[model samples]
Target: MSNMIIEQEPDDELYEHYRFEAGKGQSPLRVDKFLMNLVENATRNKIQQAAAAGNIYVNDVPVKSNYKVKANDVVRVLLSHPPFEYLLEPENIPLNVVYEDDQLLVVNKEPGMVVHPGHGNYSGTLVNALAYHFENLPLNSSERPGLVHRIDKDTSGLLVVAKTEQAMAHLTKQFADKTSEREYIALVWGNVQEDEGTVEGHIGRHIKDRMQMAVFPDGSQGKHAVTHYKVLERFGYVTLVSCKLETGRTHQIRVHMKYIGHTLFNDARYGGDAILKGTTFSKYKQFIENCFKILPRQALHAKTLGFEHPVTREFLRFDTDLPEDMQDCIEKWGIYSKSHTIEEE
Candidate 1:
């Protein structure tokens, strides 16, 4: 049997990273054909395409689809999130293009838009918009055309898109090499005790609830993930923080913050929607609920993204302001905190 071992660093847009050790009894076969047997839901065309993109490796060296796999051979594959199950259809969704050129484009994505079609979302995504806006864009392993990285659907922020195959490969290697820079602004429940700290843990899919991810503190399971955070502002019941990712595992910021007992404000999945801190006074309760109404999703924003240009090799960086809902929510907290201090005085 060909058993698989997977490894990854935190918050990466590449969803599935796999390593396979071929059984001693395995016969030589085309690498693409071999992968077709190992990876589920993968078609021969997709596997060949991945090989063409240099996404498949044998013995740590990139290989072509025609390369033959032998007994005990080691193979690795990196596929982006949201499996490529359906043909892409372009949609005319409006995009906030921050920067664009012949090589790539930078977009300031608004909140509540899916990055790609998958699971419950199959239309009106950033990919759909990109497909409509550009023709003949390079397709990544996940079939997300031109997407180098992505933020969560409900999170607002910047993402880079490649316009050419060379750009796609160059950008993917940059992210894989950990040379790209991404920082997020988040509002989490309760005042953070430390001005700055790093959270380290192994994150994997939850055993019982496969839809959610859990951190394994002992390294018994999951991939190594790291998030470095600094306090940006503080309210009595909540705090604002900036998080810099050293690794890009799925849900790294959200899960790490929750693991440290400071979940992102209004993050429903991690229990941040509840009043984890503050007084039980009805007025206080009403205020918290109002803030929830202001920003129904998690208060996280991809505020900054930096990378080297794929073609020009010039270093580039982009920053964006907080979305209106998050801004209004923060302003409300500021006002409430000041009024409460006056009452106590």
Candidate 2:
């Protein structure tokens, strides 16, 4: 099982905090062995290092890795944040910096740009551009420079980058506390009936498909997430909506929307790429295909971001226009809806 690392804090000296409770029928087991069973990608050596740092606690008492975890005992683990294993290479990529000061910078990130280097993406990320543009920025828990929060590679939006460790901590705290505001504009399949509503669920990686996130409505697994949405416009077949996040779990918006039976239009992963709604008529199918061609990715955009300035402590908000692809897709839908309704009338 993937250990749940609470995203409650970030600093130069940040740590990953996790809490686990022994089951009622759980037999006594070595703490490290018990943890190795629960925490994915964690090695015995790393757990030992944390124990050596007095970071492992059993019922408020620090314990060694070999300590036997008894039934009903609460276990808490804190490990120093691990650095990125790969060396960072600066690349001169253009950045759409909306605002900048000594303490921080606000960027209007374009879609299709990965935020950080990992796996197959070792270059051409936002971090690479930031490293080239700025001088001597601080690294966060993930070892990425300046980034406090990130949107998906296909989601365009405003992101804040801290120039200093203190700024990163402050910004991270705001996000963890849910004080920061993030609003997304999305075009979803089917006409959403409710003018506004909220989706509450736990979001985690799918057991079968590790690449996709699945919603656990019963809270049996995954991190708690909430998404509030209001309808912006309604076409006969699709609806545009604005979503506000109460939690920042990975793919929270996408998974929550899908759970509600209105997956985002053209979202290939969540079954939105096909003709999920609308008529069986060939003309309607052609129109839908044309719209999909215009917008190849999920119809979600991080349109606005609000947070307190890390140094000045003043509330700061940034908003950006939807990129051309999404705008074009919405326009096509609007025209198609008008003509289709008129023909029916």
| Candidate 2: clashing residue pairs, number | 0
Scored by Cα lDDT, where does model 2 land? 0.82
lDDT per residue for candidate 1 within 45-156, as digits (tens), equals: 9999998976787875678999999999988775544334346789999999999999999999999998876444667889999999999899876556898877788889
Model 2, position 257: C-alpha lDDT score? 95
lDDT per residue, candidate 2, 297-320, as tens digits?
899999999999877789999999
The pairs that clash in candidate 2 are: none
Which regions of candidate 2 deviate over 4 angstroms?
1-85, 342-345
lDDT of 1 at 275: 88
lDDT (0 to 1) per candidate? 0.84, 0.82
